[model samples]
Target: MARHPVRAKDFAVGEEPATVVVGLIASPGPAAEMAEALVGGLARQMGERLPGARWSVRVVADRLVGGPAPLHELVARTRRRLLDGGWQLAVFLTDLPLQTARRPVVAHASSAHGVAVLSLPALGAVGVERRADEAIVRLVAVLVGGGDAPVDVKPSGDDGGGKHRDALLRRLRELGTVAGDDRGAGLVTGVITGNLRLLIGMLRANRPWRLAVELSRALVAAVAAGVFALVTNDIWLLADNLGWLRQTLVGAGSVLAVVLTLLLGADLWERAPPQRDPEVVRATREQVVLLNAVTVTTLVIGVLALYCALFVLSLVSVLLLVPPGLHAAALDHPTGFSDQVELAWLVSALATLGGALGAGLESDETVREAAYAYQPDRSLTG
Candidate 1:
């Protein structure tokens, strides 16, 4: 049986554990969340790798220190802040999209210092915190230099095959030299486990209440659309003449059309000019903007759904409120239940159009912030 060389005992630094403080920069909400997760995971991973190390994580709030700046400059500024603040490490987590060779890189660490930057977009709708944990561990490995084994940070999809993988691995090895030597195989397996853990964590994070709050405004628009659909009688005859399938398609198509219109008018594709002082590359920023646009579109779809439901309820109200004979009299060529069904669908389409007004009522900043989960103008108080 082969013995595993890297274990808890191998990391025992001394009786006195060293403490490392990490500074987090970015949007307040997400930065705070990321800071909490990173700090929590440090004791678990680093304790095994460096048993005598203690880690503290805090979100940085000083305008003089944090904001949407170029990565190199952000890192340099953060380094100075951390050092002056008597901290050991600084990590800037940004929602800004980052890519290398058209492929997303989740994180990058400076070889000369204990500073690192991670992109939120690279987390890609999964165990974001778990990926962060793994990336942080890899960063620490490079900064502290304990494990002699080469570190591999390539994300799941690498198109370069053998040469690319080998070159990246060599570059990582050259980053720093550590005290212990272990085959790279175990480290690879650990990272794979980290990815799996992230998937599960994301699943748990998606609770119903959070989703409800996120879509509350959209739901309000849907209800308003439904109300407008119920009260209007001009389209009843057209609806009565149309087939169920056609009605559904019309309703769905209307919702989609309005959504596209909103996306175009919203200017989600606009990008900030490149900065020279900090020197940043925004190759993947458009993709992030596109994603936010889609999110806003989804809200439009949700409003349409609400409007349909309310329209149905309003139609039912008509049936209950008005006498059967009266409803038939109201329709010129009424066909009983069939006429009502047609009327409902036709009204839904129009109501969905009205929902566009509600969407427009939403402030552009609100929609943008909701789409990305980051409040750009928000400043940390106290």
Candidate 2:
């Protein structure tokens, strides 16, 4: 008989050859894109390290673990699902922010379950895509046993002595145990940071050309309103009657109202839920609500700032068209610096209302697309 090749189990000098399934677990946002890039093209890169194993990457958008559940419970549930799905190893790339103690963690892994979770926010500021790739590569090493892995698989410190990596390992070891409990310490921090990411995502979704068109429309409407006020002598009459304080408050209120209306009418605050169950998607919906509020507030503030700038320019243009000296002769009331200030406020307030009209010109689809542009296309997940 021909000599039998060494059996896979008998070849015990090396780690067992296993199928590692990288699960891109996300909340239906930009994090999905980050995960797709990481997992879809990860096999070639990971092949250099775990040459004996097979790798499969899939987007697990359903069954999110970002809840009040304990760490171990979360890990166990996720591990069970992955293993039952025919994966020996599972890794989750999540957009939700994760932390230990009072500090944020970039990634966490549990070798016992062969599961790892990476927090997308940890790769902050810039170079997020590159950092995400590096982080996953290192985390995978931990899942497969770090010894003899590729050079780039190191998490921190020279020779594995890095404090950051060590701390991460400590946390990883405590997964699915009482030792890992932090009693929701990370929730507040996660919400705050997650909202910031949401705002950035929304901004990124709005293309430059779309923003320009919207801004131009608003400016034209505002200019028309301002010029009409000046030409019809409404600004002078209102200025003579209203005090500066009242004028300022009215202008501020107008902008605020228009902003709120746009935010509400456009339904920019709502998020598309990825799962079917109401209870399962509740936490995600809450996150979307908080993030939507933040994004809408940021957009409103930006619009108000721009409106102020244009209002000043319009005032300057008005002065050039009809000087203050000419205004005094035509006015029934004495024209003074205070009056001019009041006129400016009135014009700004009226212009804000005009902006509401301009905002209406934007198609509903454009607003929705711009609002959720950063969100991953669910169809592409398949």
Candidate 3:
């Protein structure tokens, strides 16, 4: 006699596989983008890999974390959302970098609550999407299978067995360490690589190019200054005389000046919060330092992008408006393409200095909104 292949529900005759609904609550911006991009595929993958149940996913964009909050409290809040929405499992994806015991946290999962919180920055600045996909699958499996289940969930494409599995595990470990307690079952806490990974991740999240775009007044001032320098004979002479070393120095100095002006004028620097507890105070100080570093780096990148734009604009103006013969006559020497480039270089530097003055026109709120480090209620004591 021939036998039929048994289905999972066969043991409990006439039973259907349970449907498990998963909620992906993502913070606005990158977190939302990631969640939206992965939701459909993630749901399908979960259904295929975990055969006992059918999986469905929903994405919600809302800011869940802004200031310091206890891990248990965050879990509780997420659990409430899950229960309220009738979700069997919930994952909170945040762009903000999280830390516990001075170590960066990548993901924290609570089997009891059926919720997990992932700090995107702790995944590093590269390959974040793939890493996040793997994490979500593994976390979902762990949550659904109870705390005793294996944390590793190999991708369906993996055929190398232990080697591929080991490689994946190693990469995940590099992202963070697994730390947990009674409050949470699976807690992964460790820096991506070191402090540099956090800095790079923060920079990526800041999107400094947007900062350059927002400084409209400064850009106008820079263009005006570049135009004036292009028309002046004295600037032509100075560009002819100044060596490449001096030109580089001038450019670096101008960028530094703009960075400083923005930092001071806009008051972008952060000060550590006052707290009675020594640990809280220390943690806040570290956070302040990281925020300041991110702020300064953000300004530098923005100013440098502005400078590059000015240089390109000046170069085109010099090429179109001033003839090579006229430039050579003004410099009292034979000139070529290099002379035009040098002129543009110097003009951009001078224009950047003018931009520093124009930066004052931008309100503090405008600049702060463009930066990722701006958290209105960021207090460790809270």
What clash count goes with each model?
2, 2, 0
**Model 3 regions more than 4 Å off:** 1-193, 373-382
Candidate 1 per-residue lDDT over residues 161-190, each given as its tens digit: 334333333322222111121224443343
* The 10-residue segment with the lowest total lDDT in model 3: 181-190
Ranking by lDDT: 3, 2, 1
After superposition, which runs of candidate 2 have C-alpha atoms over 4 Å from their true positions?
1-190, 193-215, 271-282, 369-382
- Put the candidates in TM-score order, highest first: 3, 2, 1
lDDT of 1 at 170: 33
User: Listing every candidate in turn, what is its Cα RMSD in Å to the true structure after a full C-alpha superposition?
Assistant: 15.9, 15.8, 15.6
Best by lDDT: 3
Task: Give the TM-score comparing model 3 with the true structure, all chains together.
Answer: 0.52
TM-score of 2: 0.48
What overall lDDT, based on C-alpha atoms, would model 3 receive against the true structure? Answer: 0.66
lDDT of each: 0.48, 0.53, 0.66
